[model samples]
Target: MRRVWTSYAFRRILQSVFVIWLVSTITFLLMHFMPGDPIEIMAGRLNSAGMSHDQALATAANIVNYDPDASVWAQYLDFLKGLVTLDMGNSLTSPSKTVFDHVMEYLPWTLFAVGAGIVLATVIGLSIGMAAAYRRGSAFDHAMTSIGSFLTGVPNYILIAAVVVIGYTVLGILPFLDMRGRVTAGVEPGFDPVFFGDALYHAILPIIAFAFTATGSFLLNMKAATTEVLTEDYVTVARARGLKPGRISRSYVGRNAMLPVIPQVALQMGTLVGGSIVIEQILDYPGVGQMLMSAISDRDYPVVQAAVIILATSVVIASLIVDLVLVKIDPRIKTEGQDA
Candidate 1:
């Protein structure tokens, strides 16, 4: 068992490194060759504010570590060296801030919102899905399945826009919910209830948008898994033994049905940071997605590169962790791996 786990971990680590390196290289190349120049954009803004063309050009180049005169090969080599040393350097838009600083500043809030949304979606999905399976083909099941399908198809940003418009125009109320930001201004940042409550209040719309859209897919998956498990011979044996229906549903059917969903959850975890970009922008939420959008608009290459690396690395690591967890949870996986 130890040997198997050790081998698995070692293989996964190599795979993760390769995946991250590939993604990082692609992102770096794209950012470098993209039409807009961060230094030129910065120079333009500075020039507008009365700085001489020469001064603005020099300042911009210094801040972003880019020189139009320098060869692309030289720039690429410098970027590679910085990456190897874990030095992402300064942001072109905000020269005072390092790439790591920007990531640390915005990533946690995204994690909070996305993590809460995923958990909420999972609970709601699994509960409704299991019930629908028990009543498969009934009116209730059809109703739930239909709603889930519709919700799954709708994009989360659309949901956010719709809710904002409805809340303001139709309902004639807006401020009561504190619909933007991680917290209301003037609230002290702490572990206190007031601060926490305010943060959660501001997060409600973004969270709802993510959870509602995410729930539909999770619901459909859970329902399909439950349906298949319900027809299994073990389920039949459980029913024939005069087992209580609820026990059979919960223990025999529900437990087995959840196996497939575990992998889906891992994939969701991987994408949450990257996937929240649109919804976060619509809701004005402070998160990695919002940060990435702002950085892109400013042509902040280092920040953009860092954000892409973070998201891709998260996906690779999450997948590896899920693989190991699945192996632990299912003996069939172990047997298959051993045979291989």
Candidate 2:
């Protein structure tokens, strides 16, 4: 048991768990410290819905599973207990649904949009970066580097704005108004092509925005990595062996060059997930980001807390997975950890 604590994977998993717990605790505290009282807010709505003041207060308290008379510490303990049980109680604003239900309903859309964008960006960036590196000092290489630098320097929101304006107002190429939600009206979700196609159609803009901003970093990094790898002795040995250019590029250059850029994928996942809030709002797509904004506006404490926890958990898990993958990609990481 003591030896397990020294293991890199075990330590990383423990650290990730700690980070998640810290995030959840902070979110719970922030919600509590916010100006409005969720119970009162719910009670007021109930009062306006034909219930007497006392009845509304009692009903709201019961529905929210929050006792106004309880000590703050007691309430916090209950919150933690609920978290442990995977029960975040019912939303103060939407008493009929649990916070988990709301999170589950909306999180997948954000995941789909952001996940697709990351994969597209990785492919485009890695391919272009490698090509540019091989042709270093040429006009095409210079052009690509300049474009990548510009893209990297600009904020994602700016890129998204540019995409919306150019595609909608200037070019009239994108049907901006028609592509406003996750699916067209009356399109029931199923395993069929229609539902999947329409969902992708609606998500295209957000995906493009994400990919556009992210591609620059990947391109720049991959280019640098590939350039550095080109000078290594092993690559020279491969060339001296009279290997086919394509084979040398794939086996010798591409595989090693990708090592440095692989970790960036996990980092980008977290960043894109956070950025999805504004992008989703601009695109008017129904996702967790929009749900989070709505919950914040309505002071729906449970929902807000749950959304934050979900996002934090995703980032932590991604980082953990990347850490493990790095050990597999470059065994030196695992060896170093064991030594430490």
- Report every candidate's CA lDDT: 0.83, 0.90
Model 2 residue 285 distance off true place after TM-score fit, in angstroms: 1.2
Question: Native-vs-model 2 lDDT?
Answer: 0.90
Writing each residue's lDDT as its tens digit, candidate 2 over 221-317 gives 9999999999999999999989999999998899899998988998899998998888888889899999999998888888989999999999899
Tens-place lDDT digits, model 1, residues 1-340: 6675657556667778898889988988898888888888878878998999999999888877666777888877887777778677778777787778878798888878887898899999989988898899999999999999988887777877887889877897866346688888899999999999988998888778778866887899899999999999999999999999989988998888988988887777765666788888778888999999998877777898989888777778878888878777776875676578
The number of the candidate with the highest TM-score is 2
On the 0 to 100 scale, the lDDT of residue 327 in model 2 is 82
In candidate 1, which residue pairs clash?
none
Most lDDT-accurate candidate: 2
- Each model's TM-score? 0.87, 0.96
